[model samples]
Structure formats: C-alpha cells, structure tokens
Target: MDSYELAIRNTVEVVTEDELKELLKKPEKSVYTGYEPSGEIHLGHLVTINKLMDLREAGFKVKVLLADLHAFLNQKGDMEKVRELAEYNRRCFEAVGLKGKNVEFVLGTDVELNPEYQLNVLKLAQQITLNRATRSMDEVGRNMDAPHVSQMVYPIMQMVDIHTLGVDLALGGIDQRKIHMLAREYLPSIGAKTPVCMHTPILNGLNGKKMSSSEGNYISVADTEDNIRKKMKKAFCPPEIEENPVLQVLKYHVFPRLDSITLRRPEKFGGDREIISYGECETSYAKGEIHPADLKSACTEGLIEVLAPARDYLGL
Candidate 1:
C-alpha cells in the first residue's frame, strides 16, 4: 500500500480526508498522540502505537506525550506516582517499537507548565464554557458525576497541547474524538492552525465488553507466553466475524506487524493453512473453514511473536 493508505488503514475516521491528504504532501509533517500514564500498556494502547509506526514509515515525525500531568488531572494517581508511571510508560512504548530518531517522547509537565503554554491554556479556557469542556471530556474523564475543577481544565489544556507540540496532525482513539473536535474548533481561534485529527477504533476486551483494567480483560505487553495462552483460551471469540475479539486482535494487532499467520492443525482437521491477509482469515472463519480454537491459537502465537522484541527489551 502507499503512504496515505498506510497512514489511514484500520482508522475509524480522519476528521477530513482531504485535509490529511494535503498534509501528507507537505515535506515536514508531524503527528502526535497523548497517553495518560497507566499501570500497564495494553493492546488498546497498541492500536495507536501501530498507527504511529505506520506514520513513521510514511515519513511523518511522530510525537508521543506521556501525559503525567493529565493523568493527575484525570485523577489517575498522585503526582509523584503519575510521574513514575510516565517514565515506565515511555520505556514500555519504546519496548513496543515506538523508538528511533523520528519518534520523540515528551513529558506533559515539561511543556505544559511553561508560561506560554499556561497562558494559551488560560486564554482558551476563558472562551470555552464549563459545560462544553465537561462534555468534551465525557469519555475520557474519570468520575465525572462529581468532577473536580481540574477535570474541567483537562480538555482545554489538551487543545493547547496541539499548538504547543506544533504537530500537523493529531492521532487518538475514537473515544477522544470529542476532545479532538474541541481542539479543531478552538485552537484556530487561538492563532494555532487547525489540526488534522485521525481516530482508530477502540478494541473490545477479551470478554467482548469494554476493555477495563479492573476486569483484567485485556492483554498487556508484559504478559508472558503462558499468560497470553491462558487469556486467549478464555477470550470471547464468537464464530461470526463481526466484533470477534480474537479476530480483532489478528486484524488490529497481528497482521499489522506480521506478513502472514499460519494456523497449524492435525491433518484430519483440514491440516495446516497459511492466511495471507486479515480479510482472508476473516472469510475463512466466516465460512467455517477455520474453527474458533484454531483461530485463537494462531492469534496467540502471532501475539507472542510480535511481542518478543518487547519482552527481550524488557528482559522479561
């Protein structure tokens, strides 16, 4: 596929396809995705990381923000703990292959605390209504029923981050679309150019429900091979192709990194088969050409292989 295709594949939406195409033509393009530091970097985070890799291949300078301050504002943890998580999160990101000269890792406090950033944030905060800010953060903010004042400032600060980073495009999961839309609408008013926003789908947890940390329904990069096998064994992989968590793993996580996936089986059960593309794998499963057990096994193996580099980097 071409550069533009690579940049957009598996994405749920690009705010304006025309805008992204235009930006791709420019010689020095940059894109960024911000992550609030968490205890573990799971498959949900990998979706954007994979997209970042694609962008890097497409010749865009990539920026990953370890939003420690944002995590604190979102009530994730105390300041010291959040900052600690940010450092570990950066190492996790690099372990998963988001490193290199073209890729940059920035701490949220490093830039967000600067006078110019704070000034712009305050300037924009004055114009955005409290209700608008709260609504923009509906999907991202934690415990919004009784939100702290810091939560309200989160979205506005995020808008200013686009300008502070000086990136041409902003990449995030679909859950962040509301906040990104807020940025597109308000940043231009602050003299910053409108940002091209790209969003990827949020994959369901292994249980077929929303991916949640408390539920332990997601797979983290730090999972051992046995852990992956155990998780896949229990994953909710329905026969139907749509919304199949295992197939989603193959499509979003596996195929993006591996050229092909082989499903090994006994000779009596259609023997071993090599699937060249996600579409083919999906079709075979839909037609009963591949069984759920076989598909899960293949996905488990593929994930193990894909994460081997990370495991090695982490000495796991």
Candidate 2:
C-alpha cells in the first residue's frame, strides 16, 4: 500500500496526506519518536516502537530518543532507579528486535545542554508564545497550574530535536500531537522544514481504561508467559459487552494471522469455528453467539504464543 493508505489503516492522525506523501517520497529525510524512561516499558511503548520500525523499513532514518531528562522532569523517583530503568528499557528495545545502525538511541540529558542544541531550543521557544505552550501541556499530562519553567520549555527542546536532527517527520502517540504541532509552528521560523507528525491509536488497558503503570493495570514488555497468561485469564472479558479491552489488546499486538488461527478454532483446536478478526469476536460474544470462556482462552493462548519470543528475550 502507499503511504496514504498506511497512514489511514494505522490511525495516524495528521494534518494533511499531501505533506506526508511528500515526506515519504524523500527517502533521505529522517524521523524521530521518543519516550521518557520513567518506568518499565509497556505494550503502549511497543506500539510506537513498532511504528518507528515500520517507518524505518519504509526508508526513513529513524531516531528513538530515551528521554532521561524528561523522565526526571516528570516522574519523581530515585535517581539510581531512573538510571537503571533507562538502561533496562534500552535492553528491552534490543530484545524486541529493534536495533542496528539505522535506529539511533540517545539519552535526552546527553544532548539537552549542548550549546548548539540550547540555541535552537531558544529560537523555537521564541517563535511560539507562552500561551500556545501552555495549551500544549495537556498532551504531556501537565496541567496549566503545574507548569515548571522546564515544562514550558519542554516543547521547545522537542522542536529542537526536529531542527537539529534535520528530521522531516515526527512519530508519536496521539498524546504527543500537540508537541508536534508546536514543532510545525516553530521549526519553519528557525529555517527548518516543519516536520510532518504521525500518531498511532492509544492501546487501552484490560480494564477498559488507559493502560497506566501507576494504576497497576499495565502488562509490561518484560512480563513472563505465566504472568501474561494469568493476566489474560483474569481480565474482564464479558460476552455481552462488545468493547472488551482485552480483545483490543490482542488485536493491537498479536499478529493478524494468529488471530485468524485462534478465532477459527479449526478442528485441530477441538472445535470447528470461524473467527476472522477482533470485531467478529466481539460481535459474536455480544450477540450471545459464542462463549466468553472460549474467546478468552483463545485470546490468552494467542497472546502468549506471540509474546513468547519477546518474553524470553527479556529473560522474564
């Protein structure tokens, strides 16, 4: 499929398809996606990472920034633990088949203080007024009342990532849309081409809320097979409810072919069934056409099978 179709199917929120197509045509242009190393890497992180790899395969030079400084700025914790988390997160990425010379992994603190970097940040900050930066904080989980000077300057530094790196596109979760907007608004004033922004859908937790580590509802990238299986088994998958979050998780991460194999429940699996996609599974359950227990078992088995390699690589 072409870039436009890919963006549509992937739920990438963007300003215009023409701009994305233009950037995709320029194979030499680079792109960036970053995450603050505040805690264990979760499935949500994987969605964005996989998207970055997809872009890399599409011929864009991709950079994955480990936001160590941003972590310090946002999450309060022991410095040693935060540092450990950063290294561990890096290994997790490598374990999940995301590495090599093409993908650049750099720490946020390492580059945030460079004179040239600071200069670019200041210039970008000047382009965007304080009022605009305040509005963008909602995307990053900061409230207007909680704005630190660093928080206000955060988007500027992010914009500098696009400027200094000469990136033509920025990939982020839907949450980072505002920050990328700031980049689009500010980068041009600094003489750099405004980077096109692309975002993937946010994955929901098993409990039908945002997957959050603090809420104790998240499945980490390093979860063990038994843990993963247990979590899936105990998750809330009601047959009459169509918007089952557990099913959503499966649809998002597990391979589509695996979903077909599990859903169909071919005679090999003790039943002759035909489950095509996640939507079908949900519809069947909601209509009282299929057993919830059976669907949960199929989803658990499918998720375990798909994540087994990643679990092993993480030594979980």
Candidate 3:
C-alpha cells in the first residue's frame, strides 16, 4: 500500500483525507495520540498503537503522550498511582513494537506543567462552555451523572495537548471522534493549529461485547499460550461475519501484523487451509466453508504468535 493507504488502513475515518494528504507532502510532520494510563494494556489500546506504527512507517514522526496527569484529573486514581500506571503502560507499548528511532514518548506532566501550556489551557477553558466540553468527553469521562470539575477540564487539556505537541495529525479510536472534532473546531480559537484526525474502529471482545476488564473477555499481551487457548475455547464466534469477534481478531489484530494465517485441522474437517487475506477469511466464514470452531482456533494461534514478542520482551 502507498503512504496514504497505509496511514488510513483499518481506520474508520479520517477527519479530512484531503488535509491529511496535504500535510503528508511536508518534509517534516508529526502525529500523536494520548493514553490515559490504564492498569493493563490490551487489544483495545493496540488498535491505536498499530496505527501509530503505520504513521511512523509512513515517515511521520510519532509521539505517544502518556497522559498521567489527565488520568489523575479524570479520577482514575491519585497522582502517584496514575504515574506508575503510565510507566508500565510505556513498557507494554515498547514491548508491542512501538520503540524505534521515529517514536518519542512524552509524559503529560512534562509539557503540561509548563506555564505556557497552562496558560493556553486556561484560555481554552474560558472559550469552551461546560456543555461543549462535557459533550466531548461522552465516550471518555469517568462519571457523567454528576461529574467532577476536573472531568470538564479533561477535553480542553486534550485540545492543548495537540497544540503543545505540535503534531500535524492526531490518531485515536472512534470513541475519541468527538474530542478530536472539538480540537479541530476550537483549537484555532486559541490560536493553535488544528490537527487532522484519524480514527480506528473499536473492536468488541470475545463475547461480541465491549472489551472491559470486569468481563475478562479480551486478550492481553501477558496472557500465556495456555491462557489464550482456554479463552479461545470459550470465545463467542457466531456463524455470521459481521459481529463475529473471532473474525474481528483476524481482520483487525491478526492480518495487519502477519501476512497470512494458516488454519491447521484434520482432513476429515476439510484439511488445512491458508487464508491469505482478511477478505478471503471473512468470505469463507460467511459462506459456511469455514466453521466457527476452526475460525476461533486460527485466531487463537495468530494472536499467540503476534503477542509472543511482547511476552518474551516482558519476560512474562
């Protein structure tokens, strides 16, 4: 694929593909995404990380903002706790192949604490109404019924993050679309450059539901081979192609990393098969040529292979 195609691959949408094309022509350009420092890094986070890697491959400098302060402000935890989570999240990101010459990791506190950064944030706060800010965090804010003051400030900080990082593009999952749109709309009001935005689809879990820690339906890099097999055995893989979580893993997580996936089964079960493309896999499954059991097994094997490097790197 070409640079534009690679940049936009597996993405749900780009705010303005034309603007992204124009920005790509510049010799020097950068892109970034912010993370809220969760306790565990799973496939949910990998979607954006994979896109960031693509942007890096396309020669755009990539910045990962470990938003420790934002995590704290959003009431994830106290300052120290969120900061520690940030460090672990950084290590996990590197283990998953984000480390390289073109990638730079920035802490939210490092630049966010700067007087100038704070001043810009305050100015933005004045212009952004509570209704707009609250709307922007609909997909991200912790508690919405009666939100804390800090939750209201989170989106503005995000807008400032784009300006402070000086990235030409901002990348994230579709959940962040509202926030990115807010940045595009309001950043110029604060005399900051608006960022072209890219977003990837939010993959559902093995149960065809939201990937949440409480559900334990998602796979993590730290999972052992045996653990993966166990989870795969119980994964919800319906016959249909549209909402099949196993196929989603194949399409979004597996195919993008590996060239192809080979499903090994006995001749009695149609013998072994090599799927060269996600389209072929989906088509085969949809046609009933591929059984759901076989589909989940292949996804399990592919996931283990893809996450192996991280397992070794972390010595887990």
Candidate 4:
C-alpha cells in the first residue's frame, strides 16, 4: 500500500481526510499517541502501537508519550510508581517492534513540567467549561463517580501535549475521541495548530466484553504459551461474525502481521486448509465452511506466533 493508505489503514475515523492528504505531501511530518503507564500492556494498547508502526513506515516521525504525570493525575498510582511503570512500558513497546531511530519515546514529566507547557494548559482550562472537561474524561478518568480536582486537569494537559510535542497528527483509540475533538475545537483559540486526529476501533475482550484489567479477559504480552492456549480454549466464539472477539483478533492483530493463516485439523474434518486473507477467512467462516473449534485453534496458534518475539524478549 502507498503512504496515505498505510497511514489510515484499520482506522475508524480521521477528523478530516483533506488535511491528512495535504500533510502527507510535506517534506517533514510527525504523529503521536500517549499511554498512561498501566500494569499490563494488553492488545487494546497494541491497536495504537500497531498504527504507530504503520505511521513510521509511512514516513512520519513517531512519538510515543509514556504519560507518567497523566497516570498520576488520573489516580493510577503515585509518582514514583508510575514512573517505574513508564520505564517498563517503554521496554514493552520496544519489545513489540516499535523501536527505531525515527521513533522517539517521550516521558510526560520530561516536557510537561516546563513553565510554558503549564501556562498553555492553564490558558486552555479557562476556555473549557467544567461540564465539558468532565464529559471529555468520562471514558478515561478513574473514580469519576466522585472525581478529584486533578481529574479535571487531565484532558487539558492532553490537549497541550499535542502542541508541546509539535506533532502533525494525534492517534488514539475511539475512546479518546472526545478529548481529541476538544483539542481541535480549542487549540486554535490559543494560537496553536489544530491537530488531525485518527482513531482505531476498541477491541473487545476474549469474552466479548469491554476489556478490563480487573476481569482478566484480555491477553498480555507477558502471557505464556500455556496461558494463551488455556485462554483461547475458553474464549467466547459464537457463530455470528459481527462482534465476534475471535474474528476481531484475527482481523486486527493476526492478519496484519501474517501473510495468511492455515486452519489445522484432522483428516476426517476436511483435513487442513490455508486462508490467504482476512476477508476470505471471514467470508468462509460466515458461510459455515469453517467450524468454531478450528477457528479458535487457528487464532490460538497464530497469536502465539505473532507474540513469540515479545515472549522471547521478555523471557516469558
């Protein structure tokens, strides 16, 4: 695929298509995605990491923000704890093939503590109402039932990050659309350029529910081969194609990394077969040509192959 196609592949939406095409022709361009240091870097986080890799291949400088301060502000952990998580998360990102000269890792505290960054954040805070700020953070903030003053400052700082980093585009999951839209609407008033936002679909957990760390429904890079097998065996794979988590994984994570997937089965069950594309696989599965057991088995082995590098890097 060409640069433009590569940049926008698998994305749910880009704020403006014309702006992206114009930006693509520039001699220099940059894109960024921020992550609040979490306990586990699951497949949900990989959605954007994969996109960042695509952006790098598309000739854009990629910035990955390990938002230590953002995590602290969002009540994820204490400063020291979150900073430790930031370092670990950086290694996880690198282990998953996100390292290169063109990709720079920026810690939130590195640039966010500057006086100028603080001033821009406060300036934007003045224009954004409390209701708007609260709503913008609905999907991201922790303990929103009774929020702290720090939670109100979270989204404003995120907006300033786009300006302070000087990136041409912002990439995130669809959960971040509200915050990105707020940046597009308010950044121009402060004399900073409005950012072009790209959002990817939020993948469901193996059980076809919202991915949550508390529930242990998702796969982490650190999971062992045995753990992967056990989880995939119990994963919810219904007959329907739409909203099927197994198919979603094959579409978003597996096929993107592999040329094709082969379904391995015994001689009685139509033996083994090879599928070359996600579309063809989906069509065949939907037509009942492939059984659910074979589908999950293929997904289990494919995910293991895809994550082998990570497993080796992390010594898991």
Q: Candidate 2 lDDT, tens digit per residue, 1-316?
A: 5654644445548656678787777748677887777567777787877777667777777787877766665554455666677888888888766788688887777778799888887777666888888777776755457677778877777778777666777888888888888778767787888778888878777776777876767677778878877877777776546457666665666643254735445455457575766677666677776666677777777777766766788777
Residue 263, candidate 1: C-alpha displacement in angstroms: 0.8
lDDT tens digits by residue: candidate 3, 1-316? 9998988989999989999999888999999999999978998899899889989989799999999999999888999999998999999999999998989999999999989999988998988889988888888887788889999988989999999999999998899999999899989988888899999999998888999999999888788999999998999998877877888888888999999898888999889999999999988888889888888888889999999999998899
Q: Name the best candidate (by lDDT).
A: 1
Per-model lDDT: 0.94, 0.72, 0.91, 0.93
TM-score per prediction, in order, is 0.99, 0.87, 0.98, 0.98
lDDT comparing candidate 2 with the true structure:
0.72
lDDT of 3 at 68: 94
- Give the C-alpha miss distance for residue 83 in model 3, angstroms: 1.0
What ranges in model 1 sit over 4 Å off? Answer: none
lDDT of 1 by residue, 234-302 (tens): 999898888889999999999999999999999999899999999999988999999999999999999
lDDT of 3: 0.91
Measured over all alpha carbons after superposition, the RMSD of each candidate to the real structure, in angstroms, is: 0.7, 3.0, 0.9, 0.9
